[model samples]
Target: MPNSANLGHKKKVFDLFAQKVLVVVGKGGTGRTTVARVLAELGTKTGRRVAVIAGTSGTHFLAKEDPLLSFSSLEPGQVLISYLYEHGLGQLGKRLSSTGLASIISTAIPGIADLLVLAKIKQMERSDAADLIIFDAPASGHFLRLIATPKGLADIAAAGPLRKQSREVLEMLDDPTRLGVAFVTIAEETPVKESIETMKQLKKSSGIVPCALFINSVLPSIPGNEKVQDLSFLESTSPYYQAAKYMRTRSQSQKHYEAMAAKAFGLKPIEVPLVPTVELSEDDITYLADIVELQIRSKK
Candidate 1:
């Protein structure tokens, strides 16, 4: 049996997992997939059923054998077919797809593919298919359009199933308790700038802001009082000394950008340190998850 304090901590830790949907987006190469994977793994630690749905990528990097964590990726063509079937247009969907007309149709209708994909996610939420659904979205620019599709359609359609579906999705976007959005960025000028701009666009387009921002691959500072100037003589003779100086310089640079990001987003960013590994092992993910759990716990 757990003590009162232990139980309370557990509840606080899992409060983030209580959200029905979490959407992650970032500039390419910022490790949005890694964050999604870690979130899914953490949710399973508490016996929650978690699934990661990829918008433009595959979920093969996730733990395939984990019973509590399921994975899926969305292909527009397939989603459109299934969506048509669900909405009573199976025959037409089949005819268009079989003759390669589906691509043309999708291109002709802006946001149709996005709407269909969102409809599938909406269905999964309604049917209780998973306790937590994490959507690994495309690059931030594309994601802005993906999320804005529902409202655009709703505004244009006066009365129809299309309008009804659009309104439902908009409701999900507006509900913070049901849906949480997070952005990831590296400690660099371009990514930091793009993240701020994209976040502002999301707010302008939907009146919704990200719940959290994560700064990935932050260099950990080494403890030392010895200045690089004091070690200049050794740096001329030793590669090891040169490497240390480079890292110290890089770490300082990262801090500069990290502070800029925090001020622009108006949220203290969660920093995931750069792991010293050629390939991330399970332990590395667990270590990062511990950071996320502690951060959430502190807030609670």
Candidate 2:
């Protein structure tokens, strides 16, 4: 139901939520967290139960007053305790997780911490605790490792409980109808190139391509740069003309990279306008969410 002629050419993100898990990823500093937060806000506003999880502190980004959202940070010890408490081992969970041995054990398991992150997310979705889980997964390199963990375990553990658990996590991660990646990138040489390669590695590893590509912080084309340029006398002397020309040049560069990404990844990148500010409030986040929401809403 997404409306943009550009977005209409690809899968609407709202449709992807029906599968329940969205992993937002990109190179560091590409606003992956920003994208995850906006997606959570928009999903909550649209009446779905939403959870936002990150490896860092939850209080760092989420507003507690919002009842529609549940936020959590990924911590192995806490997850182990929570898992134990759920299965009627509350006293044992608390005592063991409180000790240093729990940390040491988690470290010993190659990807236990990250796999628990996925396990917790899928459990929340399956239990109907949330209609959608937006995961602010680590940047590209680590994300690939996280998804590959279960498979690696499956390859090693031929049989028994660990094998069974690994298979379950593997199925959940590869369930494209539900779990998918959203690649966020800025319009620049390195990020654009990295995005292309990341998408390739993701598909190669999990057999799932990106569900969406958000070209964040795009500068708009300066209005009537051509007309202004036509005034030959103003071209040299006018600051207005120079600024317009600069903007036009930059906008074109963005367009070129955008095109390259589309051709390489076969996704129509959603061009989110640059919000020129150092700091953002809840209202600003909502405003940005509105921009994204416009792309995925039903045409009806």
Best by lDDT: 1
Model 1, stretches more than 4 Å misplaced?
A: 1-15, 57-59, 85-99, 155-160
Candidate 2's error at 110, in angstroms? 3.0
lDDT of 1 by residue, 23-127 (tens): 888877999888888888788889999988887845447465788999898755667656667667666656555425556656666566666677678878888
Question: Residue 57 CA error for candidate 1 (Å)?
Answer: 4.3
Q: What TM value does model 2 have?
A: 0.81
Per-prediction TM-score to the true structure, in the order listed: 0.85, 0.81
Q: Which residue pairs in candidate 2 have backbone atoms (N, alpha carbon, C) closer than 3 angstroms, thus clashing?
A: 19-178
Estimate, for each residue in 1-300, the C-alpha lDDT of model 2 and write its tens digit: 111234235443444465688988888788877888888888888788888888544436745477789887875456754654665666665656444554664566656556666676767767877888888876536546667444665653355444666666778777887788788998888999988987887688767778888887778655585576586767566887788778778777777787778677787676667777877678878888887777656342
- 80: Cα error in model 1, Å: 1.9
